[model samples]
Target: MTPSEYEHEPIRGLPGDLPPGERILWQGGPEWRTFARSALHTRWVGLYFAAMAVLALLSGSMGGLLAAAASAAAVTGLLSLFAVLVARTTVYTITNRRVVLRVGVALQKCINLPLAVIGSAELRPLTGGHGDIVLVPNAVHRLGYAMLWPHARPLKIGRPQPMLRALPDAVNVAEVLARACGAIAPIAREDAPAIRPAALPAQGVAA
Candidate 1:
């Protein structure tokens, strides 16, 4: 899914009340700059537009150059704004029984995934101590990637993994998740590979 699908809201971290026996283990949000760089592909997009603007100028078309400049600025600004909004609004909660994603923009959403339903998971790291955890469910559940945008794993079909996106101290978070996952599910340590930023694949379905 995409961030556009989410509505905006004021982030309040975790809810004041949680279900009984559902103890919170960890809570954090994505870094806006990192989210821009990684999820928003800000550098690549900005560079592409910058190049287009330059090309327009090189072509000696005042109108085209102006248009390109405007287009580039608009796209970059929108993406950056959204990145900031996502960073501000999102709150990832890991509880004893589930992972709760409090995300959305105009419409705030609360997604709860029971630990028992998570078949396996993977961890991908970003620069500056941030990382992501891709939770692959064993059986079919309802939600698709669209609703989990920016927080969902990039490119997987049939069963898209719900990702804990752009988390700080990702490895430690994954460790907490791993311990929790192991407690109720049958999964191998190798299944949840903790990959570094450089090691992460460049290609993805969509951010």
Candidate 2:
């Protein structure tokens, strides 16, 4: 995953230009440190390794202790690198018409959730104004949890919800989305149908 993968994009986060009357409201990627802690579970991983190291130390073997320390360092380093890649490659876009997740590590993919298809949004607040906003798609839209992975809500494979992970100033972003959705509430209630997977822009399997 590298920045060059997305350098060819016409717009910063979107796959293509927005149609007339549709405009971007807010755009941002995850804060890498917050992402590491929340999505990557770095703290839990470190604690697990620390427990292993302690157990190894209690066994009274110098080799075991060294091995545990090395394993912990290697895993932590890899996770840190992955978190950085996720942050760098991802760009969450909120437009007047939809919320777009520009995600992927090696093969970039875009998930577009039109406001009409969005049933509701939930915010999970975190420290320092960083948080996650999970979007619940209407029952008709079936997004694959595996495809969305870290960008999808954890353990929600049955009904995958696209998440804007570890976003900075997520409250403001959520409010913008609310207002945008509110603007079309009446029209959506009467005529908007969930977008089919085939209709999604730049849809592709991602890891």
Candidate 3:
């Protein structure tokens, strides 16, 4: 869908009993990278089968080789299916008041942290040809399980915070959180708090 369509949809929930100044700033899904399968694994699988195909062609091993190829294809197909299933099992949700992550298809696992408890939010880029977001916790809490393939910012909710991975447009996600929590812009390191502009010193009093 287009960005306009996205903008039209109101931020997903009702305004609760929060103070009047509080507002629902933004809501979004994890980044597109979260949906990608490991390129290394997929490439290796393809190479192995390509070699098998070439060997079969050269040796004229028609019947037996064809059967072997079929078996290999079936196995590869199953692997692809499993990868999709895993991707679908992961989900991330961010709200003005809290962040929620859920994973697992058969048995659901969930982690939730309130924004009030968040001490800081950090964004870590996934290097080494992988693009993912890692969020660290700044305060102590049980919602410390890291989320792999997340589509949101790397946030520090409570101590031992869980890392979130695989979000799309992570930088924008981070900005939304910074504004919502009244935090300064995110920095390279997790420990540094966001810096806000200090008030100017009082001007000399007029006589």
- TM-score, one value per model: 0.78, 0.88, 0.49
Best candidate, lDDT: 2
From the highest lDDT down, the ranking of the candidates is: 2, 1, 3
Q: Going through the candidates in order, what is the number of backbone clashes in each? A: 8, 0, 13
Candidate scoring better on TM-score of 1 and 3 = 1
Q: Itemize residue pairs with steric clashes in candidate 2.
A: none
Candidate 2 per-residue lDDT, tens place, 1-207, comes to 555556688998988988999899899999999999999999999999888889888989788888888988999899999999999899999887888999998878888888888876677888898888878787567579988989999988888999999989876776677677767777765544332223221211011
State, as a TM-score between 0 and 1, how close model 2 is to the true structure: 0.88
Candidate 1 Cα misplacement greater than 4 A, ranges: 1-16, 186-207
In TM-score terms, which candidate is top? 2
C-alpha lDDT of all candidate models, in order = 0.73, 0.81, 0.47
Candidate 3 per-residue lDDT over residues 1-207, each given as its tens digit: 112222232333222233454444553333333333432145467678778877887888786578667866876777666556545555555555566555544444556655555555555433342334334445565553243222333343333444445455555556555554443214223443321112111121111
